[model samples]
Target: MTSISQTTRPAYSAASPRSDGLSTGFYKLLFMTPTILVLALVVAGPLLYSFWLSLHEYIITYGMGDLVWFENYAVMMSDEFAGVSWVTMKLTVIVVVLEFLIAFGLALLLNQSWLKFREIYLLVLMLPILMTPVAVALMFRLMFNPNLGIINWLLSLVGIPQQGWFGDPDLALATVVFVDIWNETSLMLIMLYAGLKSLPQDPVEAARIDGASAFQILWHVTLPMLKPVILVTLLIRMITALKSYDLIYMLTQGGPGKVTETISFYAYRLGFRFLDIGQAAAVSFILLAAVVVLTVVLLRIMREN
Candidate 1:
């Protein structure tokens, strides 16, 4: 019986990896060739072309001019660039801070074991996120109009004076930040709440058994454990805030003497509105570099913690 079983078993081959006419590694490379080609054509091609364009003085009316090396990058030293950079940084900081606070508060509240109607509350909070950013901006624009806006009427009923929201230089950025907070806080809330839910209960339970207060446990134990998730969430929101353009376009259009203009809007103005494609491309690359640097910094902090 043993001899018959040995005869039935197939013999081992040293070249089994290439028995099908192609080695395993070669087959993987062959299969992946199409994806590599597609990525090169669709992604790398345009990226390299844009970098090339940034090296020249390209105006739509004058066509592509002689290569000027980093001359287009000199825009970074201009006063307008300084102003827009300040605005972008200000907006990014304000929105990120406010949104994080609001979201963290709501996440803590919703994470309570005794909370009722949690799903309904989550659904209501998530409604704003369901709306497109463009639609949100347009709706807010109509609602906050100085003249025929319902927001002004509502404020008048409460004895507050009607104020220009998107049109006022002082209030335009603030109004945009409010709209952003309303639209984005839900996303942060969900992220934080998920992190909270995923945390192991042992530390929390042990803290409680050791007579630790709720706030102490949260500050010392829960928050330390949740740091990675918090960092990732903040990084994502910060990057998107840095790239803010659609909301600015729909609501303020960087109006009231460019008080609301961000780097992204500045780039758009340079390229399409002002016809300086080279400078626009240069600005875009600068923004890309800033994002990369910010990502690296955040990732290092995450790793350290």
Candidate 2:
């Protein structure tokens, strides 16, 4: 005789939740629609408008002229964008590399279990990030003032000549880069510290058992394992550097004969100062393309490694 259990139908029948294929898909689609619409409205809409504006000689004064398709871009091709580009590259590379090195070393130090007063130290380190960016820039601007500034006073006491930090073309870019480094280093430290904390102790222990020195383990095992985190951190820093504007703006205003002018600053000047919105849009698109290409190249490198 068959048992009762054998005769019982399965509880997960054809009419159960698993069989609601179309309904499940429909619900997923419905949930995703709002996000899609928002992106289309906020991001895509402006981007397309910018492109369209770039094709014309539109300006507030002119109130939108004839559609001079690609002429704005062509005009830019003949003009000198080299200086801004060079300054941008210089700032981006220096800030990212220095921040990574300094943050990585500090993160390693902080990860030591024997470190005392860790919380206090971390709080102090995080102060820069906590402060507003504009405030930080303005404070630094005062500190870097050539005359009547504390920095100049200290330099005079040390027998160093007082130099215009942001006023001198040669020194302006480097000074701005240093200020940015100070402003954003805390972010690097926080992210790297978190990455260090989340890393598994197993491989590190194994390396230690194999008689690996601290630096050896760090260089070989720890860094290799932290590859993913490192790539992400690098990408973020690079993007931020590429798009840098406000702090530089406050500190220099692309001043001292445009020595500190970056691509973003150039775009701002074209749009607002020169009132050439069409040309500004072209520069903006070029900057966006450059960022996208760099991001793609970086991702390719990460995947290859």
Candidate 3:
């Protein structure tokens, strides 16, 4: 009877903790594999191909030619390259600074609890964001037309002389800047407004209790807390402004003596118009490098703050 009881006893084996952890980790990786493969295929593939094209003296009509190494990159030393770089930097700085100021002011106004019809104001402000960039550019082009545009007509009503907004070399860049501000300020406003909404109320309440003026509180308390968001917003906007192409294409086409030409437009003009793919790719890579360096610096600043 004792031997039979021992033989029929149930097994009591338990999985080790290490084995459980390994299995859990394996499952997690199994689920993530598809996403990793997709990113490599979509993002990494095109980047590598572009870099490869930049190293060669390839023309679209003549097919891929000799591998010319860094000769294409030598275009950076050219006067035309310098001109476009200056235009790009100027546009980016102007648009970013103006937009941030406008957006921050609007965000503050909209965040006020006593503001009436706040939703209506928000909807009106967001109207530009809903419109496609192409549509905005085209509309602005029509409105700013020297003779037939409403803008010139309205100025005439106010006893002001007609201005060559886009046709005049002196005014073309400023006109482009205006259009950019009109279109892009809304996005900046939304970002800042969202940041304001998410800010903790405790610090602000404490400041009120201490009898701090509104401007004082904004400068001393709010700005420091909002620095990270502001930096991130500026970084995103700067990168975008650096890559601006569609507006120039639709409105100016880099005309008026290249006054509004940006690095992106320059690259497009080379690759498409001039058919110098290698040089164009080099220009694009240089812009990419600038954006990457700017991003790294801004990220570091954020971490430090």
- Strongest candidate by TM-score: 1
Model 3 is weakest, by summed lDDT over 10 consecutive residues, at: 10-19
> 220-248, model 3: which lDDT tens digit per residue?
98898998889888988998899878889
Error of 2 at 199 (Å): 1.5
Error of 2 at 206 (Å): 1.9
In candidate 1, which residue ranges exceed 4 Å CA deviation?
A: 1-19, 298-305
Write down the TM-score of every candidate.
0.91, 0.87, 0.89
Best by lDDT: 1
- Backbone clashes counted, model 2: 0
In candidate 1, what are the lDDT values of residues 1-305, reduced to their tens digit?
98887667543333345546766667668899999999999988988999999999999899999999999999999999999999999999999999999999999999999999999999899888778999999999999999999999999999999999998999999999999998888888899999999999999999999999999999999999999999989998999899878999998888889999999999999999999999999999999899988889887877886
Error of 1 at 37 (Å): 2.7
RMSD of each: 5.7, 5.7, 8.3
Worst 10 residues of 2 by lDDT: 11-20
Q: Where does candidate 3 stray beyond 4 Å?
A: 1-22, 301-305
C-alpha lDDT values of all predictions: 0.91, 0.87, 0.90
Q: Which window of ten consecutive residues has the lowest lDDT sum in model 1?
A: 10-19
TM-score: model 2 vs. ground truth: 0.87
Residue-level lDDT of model 2, residues 208-253, one tens digit each, is 9999999999999999888888887888889888998888789999
At residue 34, candidate 3 shows an lDDT of 97
